[model samples]
Target: METGIVIGAGIMGTALARHFLKCGHRIALIDPDEAARAAAAAQIGPSEEFITAPTPEALPAAWGPCHFVIEAVPERLELKRQVLGALSRQFGPDTLIASNTSGLRAADLARDMTHPERFAIAHFFNPADLIPAVELVPAPATSPQTMDLWEALLTRSGKKVARLRADLPGFVANRLQHAMARECFHLLEAGVIDAEGLDTLTRYALGVRLALIGPILQRDLNGIDTHHAIARYLYPDLAANTTPAQVLDDKCAAGMLGRKTAQGFYTWDARQERRAQRVEALLPAVIALARQIETEENDDAEMGEQARGL
Candidate 1:
């Protein structure tokens, strides 16, 4: 098994480390806080043997010569540059460095690195252990051999890798999400629907439909002609703001942005926390259904090939 090092003890980073341990990979977790490290260790349980480095500076000396090093730090450009530069100096030329940046350009992130050729972005989704999709973005300087190796490793670890051609902000998924969110905000600003109603509409209608078939497949099933007609009519009224919709603007102005702020679309209190937990509990079943669909597709392809041979 390949050895890996994950920097940062944030939710996503800790989850990645836990998943790596589940896959039987040797892992070294680099985080500054003792409490955070203890929390992460508890999450992984006592059975798994993994090393923890107390600081970023200690990472290089403690976990050198790792096959893969994933920097799951915050989405700050300078901080990532500093970490990558240090890793490039410490690790071998062949060590693959992956940044878990959401929408940042891989090329820009790798620009100051001494060994940019081995650098790439492996943008894993929230709750990394549960979400199987990972965006594998390569910089222009990234080597083909390095890309191939990391792709294989991630695939073996049960991640669906989408190799992106362009290093656009928000990559692919978040860009789509932001676009939808913009429109949702615009509607709320116009008083078209209440927050609860809007959430219900999405959870029941859009969410269920998208869960069964993705955007492209849904478009294919609905017929592109109908979609084009709808798009032409609705496109003109859409909000073009970099920020979220007017309802969100009002909320921010009033200092309500959800659970964090205790106010936003919906009012948040202890009761809201319970509601959130109930909503989140539905995800595992949804993921299981998605996996079943994927397995059926694979089985169908295999049977078709066998029939052709016969």
Candidate 2:
């Protein structure tokens, strides 16, 4: 078991720390505010104990030698650079440095580091304790051994790890999401659909279908030739429009960009946070359903093979 130091006690950071602690690793959570640290720790409950460091400088002294250090601060390049630089100075060359950046390039981040070989991106989805996917993006200078060890550590912590061969902007999920969202904005701007209607369509149609079979698999099952025919018409139209929709442009002009600004596609209310919790609570059951479907399919395949004596 490796000692872990997680910097930033924000929502995602605290959630990840709780998950790691559940896996029985000693964690030192570093945050500047004592009240924030105490609140986050309390939310994590009494089962797991974490040492708190009031600042990044205090982490190494307080936690001793940490094998892994995770930076989950805000999406700022300079802040991440400073934290990683400090950790490199504090720890040995063997220590793994992971940045929980969503869309940032890992190679760009590791450029100024003393030990770039140990730097990698361990991008976790929001509400880390629930989401199973963790993108393990290794920089060009990152050592193969370091990448392998980090992957193994995350797997042991009960996350499904996906290794990206290249450090592209937005990685995988965000790229797909942004592509869809761009079209969504276009539709809304054109008055093709309202927010509630769009949400309903996504929840009922694409969401349920994607949950059962992924895009590629679904295309295969539905006949790729048919997909090609649809794509042929859709692709040209999708590619033709590079301009952002005017409605979004107007919103930006007015300074409303979702929850951060308190308004965008939808108005923000504090109750939405509670609503999100209720939705997240159903994730485990949803995962279990998917697992059950997979198991049954496997069993059916085995029975058919036994019957055929193959």
Candidate 3:
């Protein structure tokens, strides 16, 4: 079994370490914070293949030459660069390094790295263990080998690998998500829809369909010409604001942050628990249906290729 070193003991880091353990990799979880490391160790439980340390230097000498090392620290460019630079020197040249940054560009992160070619972004969504997809982004200096290695590793871990053509900021998933959020916030602020109605529509209508076919495929199914026509009429009316919504700003100013503050767009308490349970129940079912759809599409493509060959 290969070794996987995960730096930072935050939520993403611990979850990723857990996933690596499940994938049968020897894991060395490192965090500078003693308490954070302790918390992660507790969360991950005890395993012979697993070890925790305050830093890579603190770990036992034999953990070197790991297969991969992923940094899941805070989303600061300089901080990430510092961590990665140190790691690049600590590990062997063959050890592929990755960042779990949500938005930072791969190019920026690799600028000062000791081995830029082996570094890339393996952006995992929140609750990494549960998320089935991981975005693989490579910097200009990154080697094709690095990309292939990451794709293979993530695929082996049961994650759908999405390779991007360029190292774009915010990447694919976050850009799409923020675009939707921008529009949603604009609509709410304009009184076009209330908070509850907005969420209801998103949960039932948008979420259900998107999970099955995704956005582009859904557009094709609904007819791109129809979408084009509607866009012509609606584009001008859509939100073009570069700033955060006034409603969201006011809520933040008042310290009414969601869940953490117990209030925001909605009050948290029993509803939060219920919502969490509902999502936990629904997501696995949605993932199952999506997999079935993908298989059918693949079968149809194969048949088309066979027909052409005949």
Candidate 4:
């Protein structure tokens, strides 16, 4: 029912566009490269509504009553600001603007926009369409209406959105993700465990439980006093530095970017990358399992309440 404009035409952008199209919204995909557009088409399929171009300047004149725009360009603070400025000029003040930045603070990205209140961070996880979780970060300058509208819109699109309390660096998920990564790299560098050992233990041990009960609930089940005691004893050994881990920095310097370059902590090739894509397909099942678990818990609580009343 709405016309949505998504700028970038990369993996995230195309995924978003595909979702929008499935929801019966017309989409205009903007990207500067023809090859990028072609690749996107290959992923999402060709459609008249899938308008592609260098910029918003090339948006179809018929894309009327466009209420939402998601800028999904690469993670560069300056580049995002520039693109946002251009979007503000094109769409006027009323149109809702969102950035799919993974780490940049919403306020910093909206600093240059003419109407800062219209901007927010709609940080979709990788493979936006497949990932149900989206971190909704709003700057203090962002309007309350913008927040409400986006929460409703994304929810209607079958997204599980977490509206963060503060628009700090890295948001919520990324901070936790990097916190884990930093420690893993530190341990790897210290020769405490090999990469495969770390990965194997992580998959079979931490990953399975985490997929169901969250860390906070796990702490509650384990007892707070026990957790506090462990934290007191273990905090000193954890990686708590601001600097990038030397192991990670040196790997990037060597251009051993995993999956794409076929080298990193583990070797990768085209076949490996293709196999990894299968992992993404399992997310729907995981989401369903989480939902069912919560529903069963809720039902049990309700039955207990009824029995107590009787």
Candidate 5:
């Protein structure tokens, strides 16, 4: 069992700790907040392989040298740099250092590190335990060994790894997400659709289609020529705002930050919260079905090719 240290005891960190423990790996969760540590322990339940410490200095001697460290602290470049620098000092050069940043560049984070080659990005989605997808991005200075190490580790741990060729802003997933979100918010501002209609449209249309086949593959099946034509017609009319949507800004300004605050575009009641939980709970099954379908399609194509040869 590999020994992993996860810094930050927030939702993503706690989920990652639990996931590692479930994979029969030893994990040390570090957070300065006593309350956050307590809450994480409670959420994960008692496990011999799992432990929590307020800092790396407090880690027990029995945990051994960390094989990997995932820094899941809040999204701030300077804070991440500080944490990573400290971790680099604490651990040897062999230990892989990864960030769970949603968008920050790995090269920028490794700028001040002693061993830039050992650092990379391993961005996990929320509810990291349930989310099967992980975007692995490496810094320009990051060694191929580091990328291979993380790819092997996460894949062995049952993650669907998307190794990005280059570290760009927001990586792959978030950029696609925000692009769609931009249009959604733009439609909202234009009074073309309400929040409910928007969710309904996305849930039934984009979500369902994209779940089975990725956008590129779906476009191929739909004829890329048609997609190109549509894009040409739609591009000019789409939202091209370089700043945050005014509606989103106004909502944040009013402290109506969605489910956490019980309001945003819509007021989230207990029932709505339960529905949201249900959706997340069902995501794994949906992803499984999508994979199964993809496999079957590939098999059918192979069989067809064999028949044609015969």
Candidate 6:
């Protein structure tokens, strides 16, 4: 069994560790904080295949080098550098040292490595275990051998990997996500769309279709002529500001930081857990239905071609 060592026992780290464990790998989860390790342990539970340690120093001295090492530290640049640097020191050149960073440039994290060509950014989405997508980003110096090894490993672990050639800001999903969010907030503040109205409209009207057909394909389905007309008229008026949204900033200043604070745009105190569970249960089925729709569309087109040939 390939050995997988994950540093930091935060939510993201713990989820990745659990994923590897489920994949039948020997997993070593290390975190400096005992409380964090304890929390992760409680969440993941005891397993003979899993090794838990408060710190790398606290691991059994006999522990050999691992096949894979991933640093799942905080988003702060310096902290990730320090943790990943230490991992590089522990493992040798053949081991692929990776960071579970969502938005950081691969160069920034790879800077601390002795062999920068071995460093990579494997960005897992929130609720890592449930999400199928992972952005596997390679630094400019990263080698083909490293990419090949990770591509095979992550695919075996059940990830729908998107190997990004360029490490652009926000990658793909996040860029489109934030862009749409920018417009959402703009409309909200202008009184064009209320919070609840916007949520319901997006979830039912746009979200359902997006799940069935991705944005570009959907554009083709609707005819690019229509897209051209909309873009010509609306592009200039869309939000282009790089600054933070005033409404969210004001809400944060007022201490309404969502579920943690029990309120933000909506009150989460009473409904948060129940709503989260519902969404979690519904997502898999949504993905399944999306796939079924795609298959049916393909089958119908094939039948049309057969009839025309006959």
Candidate-wise lDDT, in order? 0.85, 0.84, 0.90, 0.87, 0.92, 0.86
Residue pair clashes in candidate 2: none
Show where candidate 4 strays beyond 4 Å. Answer: 297-310
Give the best candidate by lDDT: 5
Provide the clash count, candidate 4.
0
Order of quality (lDDT): 5, 3, 4, 6, 1, 2
What tens digits encode model 6's per-residue C-alpha lDDT throughout 1-310? 7888899899899999999898989888998788999989888999988888977777786666688888898889999887877777767888888888878888887777788788888888867877878888888889988988888899999887899999776778888999999999999989997999999999998998887779999898999999999999999999987987899899989999876688888888557768977998887787678678867989999999999995
Query: Per-prediction TM-score, please?
Result: 0.90, 0.88, 0.92, 0.93, 0.94, 0.91
Clashing pairs in model 6?
none
Least lDDT summed over 10 consecutive residues: which range in candidate 4? 56-65
Mark the 10 consecutive residues where model 3 has the least summed lDDT.
Answer: 276-285
Q: How many backbone clashes can be found in candidate 6?
A: 0
Q: Where in model 1 is the C-alpha error above 4 Å?
A: 56-64, 243-257, 260-264
Off by over 4 Å in 3: 297-310
Worst 10 residues of 1 by lDDT: 56-65
> TM-score for model 6?
0.91
lDDT (Cα, tens digit) per residue for candidate 3, span 38-65: 9999999999999998888888887556
- The sequence of per-residue lDDT tens digits that candidate 2 reaches over residues 166-208 is 9998899898887898888777777889988999999898898
Q: How many residue pairs clash in each candidate?
A: 0, 0, 0, 0, 0, 0
